[model samples]
Target: MHKKETNLSHSKLANNMMNYINKNIDTDINIDAIAVEYGLSKFHFHRIFKEQIGKNIYETIKSIRLQKASNLLITNKYSTITEIASMCGYSSQTSFIRAFKNRFEQTPTLWRNGGYKEYSNNILHNSISSDVSHTSFSHLEAKIIKTKRKKLYYIRHQGYNKELSKVWQKMMAWVYTNNIENYEQIAIYHDNPIITLQEDCHYIACVKVDDKTKLTNTNLPYFEIEEHLCAAFEVEGIYGDILKFIQWVYHYWLPSSGFETTTFPSFSVFEKNHFLNDDGIFKVIYYVPVRYV
Candidate 1:
């Protein structure tokens, strides 16, 4: 096959992987099976997935699980935190609390009571039991473009499952103990290049800290998302499957979009309530660099 054909083939396979993730969002989805189904070894799939989506299988799963848990926290009339956590594949309440706080900056109790003001009411009220097995996303397109720069404060983190919790705990504890600032208006920026760049990505979760706040090593490496041309695309369905969709965009969409690549690494912008549902209709504006075509 020609180069273009080969790229297209991979895009199709990646799309299949996304569909499978959404279909099995509520169940114990297996990445190994997906690897096998695509005639790829686990390692190969991991590499390809990261190269395409900027994240790996583990991150994808966590994103899906958290979104489902969020949906349940607001929508399910009778679900408890324990039930929600267990159903979402968390091993314990402590674990669930840690993950929940990491993603949303609030405990399950607070989130439940607050009712999520940033997301749509539909997102908070959406059904959680629908199966994604029959769903389709074969008509999506990826486009490249230029965008303005975005300034953000970032915190770097590294570890295994829910390990970022420790970092967050330390950060928040420090914030409170020292009277640093409020986390309510801040969005944690995940800046770790590994997590931001490839499979097994780490969190550089950051909140917009006050400018006058004193800093330590735990507080920085804060930077800006530079202004440049970007390649933007949408990844449908569960966020866990986001990597493969990203792979489709980078490996296939860019080449076909008639856009020359630039140096800046891509980043995703989350819109309102974008992370609140399992099979949610979220639009992630991925920014990639573009040069003259």
Candidate 2:
């Protein structure tokens, strides 16, 4: 195979593996099974995954699990530590506590009760000031609704900032080239920016695709957003406002609303994409998947 084709093949495989791990995060993940599914020997799969993804498969899984745990500790306050542990795939509370501590340097209880502030503050260089309050969302009320399943063709981008404009540009180019006119533009936030470093957050730029769309020529990755019960809010804001809104959703609104967040990532359906606009303004319907606590 040509060098470009080989690289694309490797990236596709890595993306598939990541999706598989995330979907089955609460179950046992056998390396051998993954290797077999990909039609590669164990050693070859390990080498290729590390080379393409910059992390070994095991490291990726652990990082994803710990990230999920961190979000759960803060958002699902009503859930017990044992339940949270089990939700993150730890069989025993003891093991979960140990792993959580190793990753976040705090016990689950402490994290749930505000230890995450210190961790987040450290990562963001203490930018999470006391003045950054949740009052910004006080005037906006969320409507509870159930969303339909959606299939998306997406390009994954790491980091969250103004630079995302470039990713959107590329995505739009693809959309125009493919003559896909009927679609909703979406952005998936795979990490809590408050806890994860800004430059390390996982962001996906996606366009919802239907049966009418022709995708036989493109190499973009695809993932499905399953139907979810959500608290939906319409937001019109500038560059950093969305991040603050997300923080408010988990820290303020959710706790008081008598709801707990699910494992699925929150996403936004853009009426006006902030990244693409020169004014840096965005109009979106943000959806936070939830269930009654």
Candidate 3:
């Protein structure tokens, strides 16, 4: 197998492990069980997971649990912190508060009452939730739009914050080799990075092709981004700012938008905005699947 093929194979296993963990977050997440399920020795599985995703399994699971706890806190739907902690996999409320305070510099109650926003005005500075911020997307006009299905050839990645630049570089090489460097670029996030550990989130970077384009004789897989009625919000900024923008959209925008979501997950549609001083900024349109209430 070629180098890319090897990466793809490892990527798939890492993704599977994440999927399983997500499905069972409320339970004891056993790495040994994951190793046996994958038919790899525990040692080998641990090493491969770190190599492929750049984070240890324990760290990934902890991150996922913390993110869930924080999101629940922000939603304030749970009646008490104790219940929230248990649902997030902490057996003891005291232990959960200790862990939460250690990570966020605030207790669960404080985070629920907007202390998190004050401390993490900049989302990047926070350690508690992968998806957190007080950043405003008020500048955004997120509204419903219907889109036609798109055909694309894409590459999938699973890992803690997989380097976007590396993804673009390698994808560009493939596109350029195929003589389609000028094609439109798009990305799909199957899991929200804010809610999901960066190492565990799944994403696909795609090169757009017309319906008539043939995928034969190439190993790159092709699929359609299903058409849907969506609430779309576009933001222009550096990468970190883009993440904060997303957090704002989900944390503030969605719950009060008087709309319900559909089956498809939200995704970021990408386009280059400006390139100057060896720096490239981007314009990304984040779309959430929605239906009118």
Most accurate candidate by lDDT: 2
> Best to worst by lDDT, what's the order?
2, 3, 1
User: Candidate 3: where are CA atoms >4 Å away?
Assistant: 1-8, 19-30, 75-98, 122-139, 144-163, 176-184, 188-230, 237-241, 254-266, 271-281, 288-293
Error of 3 at 273 (Å): 5.9
Order of the predicted models by TM-score, top scorer first: 2, 3, 1
Model 3 lDDT vs. the true structure?
0.67
lDDT of each residue in 1-293, candidate 2, tens digit only: 99989988998888778778878888778989879988999999999988877789998888778888888888887899898888878889999899889988889899889898778767656444222434377889999999998988888887786678999999998888888879899999988887777777789899986777776458787878789999999998777778878878877788778888877889999999988888877899999989986
Question: Any residue pairs clashing in model 2, and if so which?
Answer: none
**Whole-model lDDT values for every prediction:** 0.52, 0.84, 0.67
Best by TM-score: 2
**Tell me, what's the RMSD of every candidate?**
20.4, 2.2, 6.2
- Please give the range of 10 consecutive residues that has the lowest summed lDDT in model 3: 124-133
Q: Judge candidate 2 against the unseen true structure and give its global Cα lDDT, from 0 to 1.
A: 0.84
Q: Write one digit per residue (lDDT tens) for candidate 3, span 1-293.
A: 99888877777677567656665677777789768988899998988788877888998778767776776665434247887677678889998999898888888888878775665455444433333434456877886899778776777676425265677677777776666534677777655555444556666677786556544335565666668998888777654565566667657776567765432556767767222113656787878776675
- Give per-residue lDDT, candidate 3, residue 204: 68
